[model samples]
Target: MDTVELARLQFALTAGAHFLFVALTLGLATLVAVIQTRATFGGNPVHQGMTRFWGQLYIINYAMGIVTGLVMEFQLGLSWSGLTEFAGNAFGSALALETMVAFFVEATFLGLWIFGWNKLNRWAHLALIWVVTLTAYASAFWIMVSNGFLQNPVGYRLDGGVLHLADFGAMVANPAALVAFAHILSGAMVVGGFFMAGVSAYHLSKRTSEQDFFRKSLRLGLGVAAPALMVTATFGGMGFGTMQVTKLAAWSGDLAAAQAEMVARHGPGDWLPPVGWVQAGGTWMMGLFALMLFVAAPSTLLMLFRPVVRGLRVWHWLLVAMIPVPFATMLAGWIFREMGRQPWAVYGLLTTSEAMSPVSAGQMRFSVIAFTSVFAVLVLINYWLLARAAKAGPAAVALGDRPIDAPQPVLTF
Candidate 1:
C-alpha cells in the first residue's frame, strides 16, 4: 500500500485500540470514585471492597491508556505533520490543556489516591479520587474540543496556508463536540456497568461466598448501565443533524444526495464513508444496545428475588457473555462516527490524503506494523490483568496497608 493508506491504517489501528482502554478507564474511574465515596461516609465495608477491587482494574486500564495516548500525541507530529502545520495553532491549545490536566491533576491525584489509602484521612482520601475522576473527565473534554475542531472547524479561519483560532469560545462550545462527548461519557458508563456486572456474575455463577457483595455489584452495574445506554443511543441518534450529515446519509442508505453534494462542492470523487458497512455497523450497534437493555432491565428487577435469581445460573452466564457487548458497541459507534467523516481529516477544510505526512511507504508500513503489534500485545496484557483481578474478587485486592484478615475498624460518621 501507499504511504497514505498505510498511515490511515496505522492511525485506525492505534486509535481504535487505544480507545478500548480509554472507554473502560473513563467509566471505571467514575465507578471507583462513587463507590469509594460511599465507603467514606457510610463506612460500608462492601463499598470499600468494591472500590479497591474495581480501582485496581481502573488503574491498570488507565496506565495503558496513558501510554497509548502519548503515542497518539507523537503521531500527530510525526505522521500527520501536514495537519499539525496547518491547524496546529488552533488545535494545539486544546491539546496543551489536556496535557496539563493529565499530569498536574489526573495523574498526580491518582497516585495519591492509590497510596494515600489508610495514610490519609478517610474523607481526604475519598476527595482525591473525586479529583482524579474530574480531571480525567476534563482531559476527555479538552481532547474532544480538539477533535471537534477537526469535525466542525468552528471558531477558526484560514490565514494564508494555516488555520488560526478566531473564536476560542466557539471552539470550546462546538455543539458537535459537546454532543459527541456526551455520547462518549454515557457509553463509558455503560461499559463500566457491564464490566462490573459481568465480573460479579462470574463470582455468583461459581457460588462464591461473597454472594451479597456480588449481588450489590450486579445491581449497581445494571442500574447505571440501563440509563446510560439510553443516553448513549439518544445522543448517537442526534449525530445525523450534527456535523456528520453525509455520513448519516450513508448510514441511512440514502447517499445519493450527500455524495452529489460532496461532488458538487469538491468536484467528482468518492466522497462518502463506507456506507453499507457503516449502516450495518450502526444497525448492529443499536441491536446490541437493545439486547443489553433487555438483559439489564430484567436482571435488575430479578435482583430483588435473590434466591430465585441465584437459581437461574443461565442469567449469570448471559451477563458474563454480555460483558464484551458494550466494548463492541463502543468500537462500532466510534467507527461509525469517524469513518462517516471520510476523505476529510478536518471535514471540508482538508482532505485526508493531503493531511498525511510525506513519509515514504516503507516508513509508514514499518510504523504501522510496529504500533499495531504493540497495541495488540497491550490489549492482551490488559485483559489478562483485568481478568486475574476480577476473578480474585475483593479479598485479593488491597484496600490499604492493613492486613486482609485484620479486624474491621468501625467508623461512625
Candidate 2:
C-alpha cells in the first residue's frame, strides 16, 4: 500500500480503538453519576456501593481512553495535513473547544468526584460528577460537530481556497451532527448497560453473598439497555438522510447509478467505496441491535417482576455472553460511517487521495505498526484491570478510607 492506504489503516485502527473506550466512558459515567445521586438523596447504602463499584470501572476505561483520544488528534496534522490546510479553520476550532471541555472542565470535575470522597459535602460531591458527565457529553458534541462538517460541509464558505465558518449556530445545529451525536450517546448507553449486566452476571453466577447488590446492578443495566438501543436504532436511521446520498446508494449495491451521479457532479474518475465491506458492516450492526433488543427485553421484563423471581444462572450466563456485543456493534457502525464515505476526507470538497501528507511509505508503515502495538497493550491492560475490580465485588472495595460498616457521613458540609 501507498501512503494514503497506510494512513487510512492507521487512522482506522486508532479511531476504532478510541471509539470503543468512548462508548463505554460516556455511558458508564452517566450511570455512575445517577447512581451517586440516588445514593445521596435517598440515603441508601446499596446505591452508594453501586456507585463505588461501577465508578472504579469507569475510571479504568476513562484513563486509557484519554490516551487514545489524544493520539487520534495527532493524525490530523501528521498524516492528513491536506485536510487541515483546506478545512483547518472550521475543523480546528471545534477541536480546540473540545480540548477545553475535556481538560479544563471535565477533568477538573472528575478529579473532584474521585478524590472528594468523604472530604466534601454530600450534595456538592454529587453535583461534581453530574458536571463531569455533562461536560463529557459536550466534548463528544464538539467532536461530532467536526465529523458532521466533514460529512455534510455546512455553514462554511470558500474564500481564497480556504474554508471559513459562515454561521456558528448552523454548524453547531447541523442535522448530521445532531443525529450522529444522539446515535453515539445512545450507543454508549447500551455499552454501559451491558458492561454492568455482564459484570453482575459473573458475580451472581458464582452465588456470591452480595446477591442483592449484583441483582440491583443487573436491573439497572437492563433498564437502560432496551431504551437506549431503541433510540440508537431510531436516530441511526434518521442519520441516513443527512449523509452523502450517493454513498448510501453505492452501499445499497446500486454503484453504477452512484458512479454516474458522482461523475456528473464532480467529474469523478472513480467513486466506489468498498461495496461488500459496507454491506456486511451495516448488516452486522443491525443484526447485533436486534440481538441486543431480544436479550434486553426479556431481562427488563424479569427485572420489572423482581422479588417474584430471582436472577437465574441461565440469565447470568446469557448476560456474560453479551459483554462484547456492544463493542462489536459500535465498531461495525463506525466502519460503515467512515468507510462508506471513502475517497473523500471532506465529502465532495476533497478526495482522500489528495489529503495525505507527503510521508514516505516506510514512515507510514512504521507508525501503523507502532501505534497498533501500543493500542493493543493499552486495551489489554484496561480490560484486565476492569475485570479484576468488577469481580472483587463492592464489599472488597471502598470509596472512603473507612470500612463499609463504619459510621456514614451525613449530608452536612
Candidate 3:
C-alpha cells in the first residue's frame, strides 16, 4: 500500500481501539453515577459497593482511554496535515472545544470524584460524578460535530481555497451531527448495559456469595440495555436520512449516477465509496442489534421473577456469552458510518488522498507498525486490569479510602 493507504490503516486501527475504551467509559460512568446517587440517598451498603466496584472499572477504562485519545490526536497532526491546513479553521474548532473544554474539565472532575471518595461530603462527591457524566457527553458531542462536518461539510465557506467557519450554529445543529451523536450515545448505553449484565452474570454463575449485589447489577444492565438497543436503532435509522447523496446512492445501488454526478461537479475521478464494505457493516450492525434486543428485552422480563433470577444457570451463561455483542455492534455501526463516506476526508470538498501529509510510504508503514503494536499492548493491559478487578468482586476493590491493610487483590493480578 501507498502512504495514504498505510495512514488510513493506522488511523483506523488506533481510532477503532480508542473507540472501544470510549464506549465503555461513557456508558459505565453514567451507570456508576446513578448507582452512587442511589447509594447516597438510600444509604444501602449494596448500592455503595456497586458504585465503588463499577466506578473502579470506569476509572481504569477512562485512564487508558485518555492515552488512546491523545494518540489519535497526535496522528491527526502527523498524518492528515492537509486536512488541518485546508479546513482547520472550520474543523479544528469542534476538536478544540472537545479537548480544551470538555476533556479538560472532565478529567479534573473525575479526579476529584476518584480521590474525593470518602473525604468529600456525600452530596458534593455525587455532584462530581454527574458533572463528569455531562462532560463525557459534551466530549462526544463536540467530536461528532467535527466528524459530522467531515460527513456533510456544513456551515463553511471557501476563502482562498481554505474552508472557514461561517455559521457556528448551523454547524453545531447539523442534522448529521445531531443524529449521529444520539446514535452513538445510545449505542454506548447499550455497551454499558451489556457489560454490567455480563459481569454480574459471570459472578452469579459461579454462585458467589454476593448474589444480591450481582442480581441488582444484572437488573440494571438489562433495564438499560433493552431500551438503549431500541433507541440506538431509532437514531441509527435517522442517521441514514442525513447521509450525503453519494453515500446514500451507494447504499441504494445508484452508484453509477452518483459517480457521474460527482465527476460532473468535481471533475473526473472515482466518487463512490466501497459499497460492499458499507453494506456489510450496516448489515452486521443491524443483525447484532436485533439479536441483542431480542434477548435483552425478554431477559429483562424473565429475570424479574425470583426463580429465573436465581436458579436459571443457563440464562446466566447466556448473558456471559453476550458480553462482547454490544461492543461488536457499536464497532460495526462506526465502520458503516465512517467508511460509507470513503475517499473523502471532507465530503465533496477534500479527497482523502489530498488530506495526507507529505510523508514517504516507508515512514507511514513504520508509524503504522509502531502505533498498532503500542495500541495492542495498551488494549491487552486494559483488558487484563479490568478482568482482574471485575473477577475479584466488591470486597477486593480499592476505589474509596479503605484501610491500608485491606487486601487489594486487584492490584496484584
lDDT of 2 by residue, 1-413 (tens): 87898899999989998899989999999899989989999988888888888888898889988888888999999999999999989777888889886657998888887877778888998899988999999999999999998988888889999898888888899998999999999999999999998898888888888878888888888888889999999999998888786669756887787888889989858887787778878889999999999999888887666552254778888999999999999999988888888878888898898888988999999999999998999899888987888888887665554533457556454
lDDT of 1 by residue, 1-413 (tens): 78888888888777887788898988988888888888888988888888888888888778888888888889998899999998898988899988886556888888888877777788888889888888888888998898888888889888998999899999999988898889899999999999988888899999998888888888888888888988988987775568566877888778799888888988999888888667877887888889888988787788778884566789889999999999998888877777777778888888888898888888887888888888888889888988998898887775474643467766566
Model 1 RMSD vs true structure: 3.8
Q: Estimate the Cα RMSD of every predicted model relative to the unseen true structure.
A: 3.8, 3.8, 2.4
Q: Candidate 2, which segments miss by more than 4 Å at Cα?
A: 307-311, 402-413
Each prediction's TM-score versus the true structure: 0.94, 0.94, 0.96
Predicted model with the maximum lDDT: 3
Tell me how far the alpha carbon of residue 306 in candidate 3 is from the true structure, in angstroms, after superposition.
1.7
Q: Give the whole-model CA lDDT for all candidates, comma-separated.
A: 0.84, 0.87, 0.90
Clashes of 2: 0
Residue 116 CA displacement from its true place in model 1, Å: 2.2
Candidate 3 lDDT (Cα, 0 to 1): 0.90
Q: Which clashing pairs does model 3 show?
A: none
lDDT of 3 by residue, 1-413 (tens): 88898999899888899899999999999899999999999999999999999999999888888988998988888999999999999989999999888999999999888877777888999999999999999999999999999999899999999999999999999999999999999999999999999999989888899999999999998899899988988999998889988888767777888898888999987888989978888889999988998889889888789768877889888998898899898888888888888889999999999999999988888889988988898899989999999999998887894633455445564
